[model samples]
Target: MSGNRSQVIIQSKRPPLSSAAPVKVTTPSSVNYHFTRQCNYKCGFCFHTAITSFVLPIEEAKRGLRLLKEAGMKKINFSGGEPFLQQKGAFLGELVQYCKQELQLPSVSIVSNGSMIKEAWFQKYGEFVDILAISCDSFDEQTNQTIGRAQRGKSHVENLYKIQSWCKKYRVAFKINSVINTFNVHEDMTENITGLNPVRWKVFQCLLIEGENTGENSLREAEKFVITDQEFQDFLDRHQSIKCLVPESNQKMRFLDCRAGRKDPSKSILDVGVQEAIKFSGFDEKMFFKRGGKYVWSKADMKLSW
Candidate 1:
C-alpha cells in the first residue's frame, strides 16, 4: 500500500482508469466514506471532527472506492471536513469521475458546506455526481454565525440558493443536512426550507462523540450545540410542513444501529480492507436504508439531462 499523502492538482482531464479491477462487497447496501475530515467550518456540534488531516493519497482513495464498488455497494456518499475544500474541487472531481466512469458505481454523491463550490466545477463534473448534500443549520444569519457555520463576508443562506440553482442546472439531486442544535433549534426554517425545495431534508439531533467532539482531543467541546430530545422534537414539529423531512434523533443516532454515528478512528481500506473497516465502524444497513440511504436519486438516477 502506498503512503497516505495529499496531491493538489488542477484536473484538466480525468485520471486514466486504473487497470486494477474493483473488489465488490455483498453485504452493505451503501457506505458513507468520510474520506477527509478536513473541514472549513468549526461548527461546535460536528461529530466527525476527530481528525483534522487528509491522509489518503488519491490512488489509495480510488483503490478503496473501487473495492467498495466491487463489494456490491450500491451507493457511496463522500463526506469530509469539507469534500469541496480541495483545489478547484479537482481532488473530489477525480474520485467522482472514477466512481461513475471507471468503477461504474450507480450512485456517487458528496456532502459539502456549499461555501466553496463554484459553477465551473458543476459544469465539469456535474454528470458524475448524483447528489449534492449541503449543510445549512439555520435560515437566520446571526443564528448561523453563532453556530460557527458562518462564512466570512459570504452569506451561507445565499450560497444555499446559489448551489441549489447550480444543482438544478447540473442535474444533481439536492439535499440539506441540518443539525438541530441549541443555537438554532427554535429558529423557524419552514419558509426558507420550503422555498429551497430539496429532494430530501435530513435533520439530525446534535450529536457528541466521546472524545471526538467532547473530551480533551476535540477541536472545540460542543457542549454549546447540545440540545435535548424534546427540543429537537419541538424543532421538528415546527417544520412538519416541509415536504421531504427525514429526522434522526440523538438516541437513534448514537445508541441505535446507525451508520453515521460511530466515531471510531477511521482507517483506510489500504490498512484494514473494506469489510473489516466497515465492521470496525458498526455501519448498520437497516438503519442506513431506513434513513433513505438507497434512494432512487442516488447512483446515476438522474431525473434531468446529464
Candidate 2:
C-alpha cells in the first residue's frame, strides 16, 4: 500500500436531499484505478489481494479513461494485485499510453511489484508514462523472503535496481514505495535508498483493511505485520537523511471511508458516467490535497536530465 489506509464506518443510508439542494460533486483529480486484483507476490500485508482474475477489455477501459479525463481527471494511476500481470504488461502499457497520448492527462503512472516488468514493455510505453512507483518493502533479501515479498529464486532487491535503471533509461521519473511493517522496521535503508536516488520515496505504515486483510472474508492475515506508531516513527527518524522521503500514516489516509468491510462496488463509470459513479467513491478532495497528494507530477514539468 503506497498511500495511507484507514477504516471508518460509512452510513449506508442517508436522508433524502431536498429537490432544490445541489448535489455534492467530487472531482476526479487524481484517481487510483485498481483495474485488476491479481498479484504474483504474496505480501502478507497486501490489502488488495487476488479475489478475481477478471480484467476489463482494453477498449472498454479506454472508454472509461476518456470519461474520467472529461470529468477533470488530471492524473490516472494504474494499480492492481499487479498491473503488469495482465498480458505480460501490455494491458498496463496500453492504458498508460492512452491516458497520456489520447486523453492527454497530465500524469499517467503505475504501481507495480517490479518483478514482471521487462525492458520491452518500457521500450514501447516509456515516453507516455510520467512516473513508475515500485513496491520494495525491505532491502534485506532474507527479510523480504520471510515477508512473502520475494519470488522463490529471484532477488527482489536486484530486480528493484534493474527496474530503477530502466526507469532512468526510459526517462520516466522513478519512485519507491515501502510499507513499513514489523519484519523490516529496524532495517536501516539509508544506504540503499540513497543509492537508488528516486525522485520520491513513499514510506507507508502497514495498514489493515476490514475484508481485505483482517476480517473473516479477508485473504491475508496482516496482524503479524502491523507495527506500532512509535516503531514507524523510529524508522522515519533513521531515514532523516533521505531528502525525498514522504511518510503516510494510517490515520492520515482517511480520505475514503471503506465501510462494508471491503471496497464496495459501485456502478461502472462507463455505464453510469464519471460524475454519478464517483459520488459513491466518498473521496475527500480537501483531505487529498492536505496529504500532499498533489505535486509537480508531469514528467515534462519535472525538468530532470534523462
lDDT at position 102, candidate 2: 86
Best by TM-score: 2
Tell me the deviation in Å of residue 1 in model 1.
11
lDDT of 2 by residue, 25-125 (tens): 55567778888888889999998887777777788777777877787788878888888988998888888878877888998888999989999888999
Clashes of 1: 10
The TM-score values for the models, in the order shown, are 0.85, 0.91
What range of 10 consecutive residues in model 1 has the weakest lDDT sum? 6-15
250, model 1: CA deviation in Å?
1.0
Cand. 2 Cα-lDDT: 0.81
Clashing pairs in 1: 23-70, 24-70, 24-71, 25-70, 25-71, 25-72, 38-81, 39-81, 106-299, 107-299
Give Cα distance to truth, residue 284, candidate 2, Å.
1.8
What tens-digit string does per-residue lDDT give for candidate 1 at 1-306? Answer: 111332111001112345583553325446666666678787887766735475577887788767766655666777777887766589999989988899877777789998889999998999899889999998888888988897778799999999999998888888999999888887898888888888889999988776568777776688888988899999889888886899988755653322343354435456766565554454444455455554575634445443
Candidate 2 wrongly placed segments (more than 4 Å): 1-24
lDDT of all predictions: 0.73, 0.81
Clashing pairs in 2: none
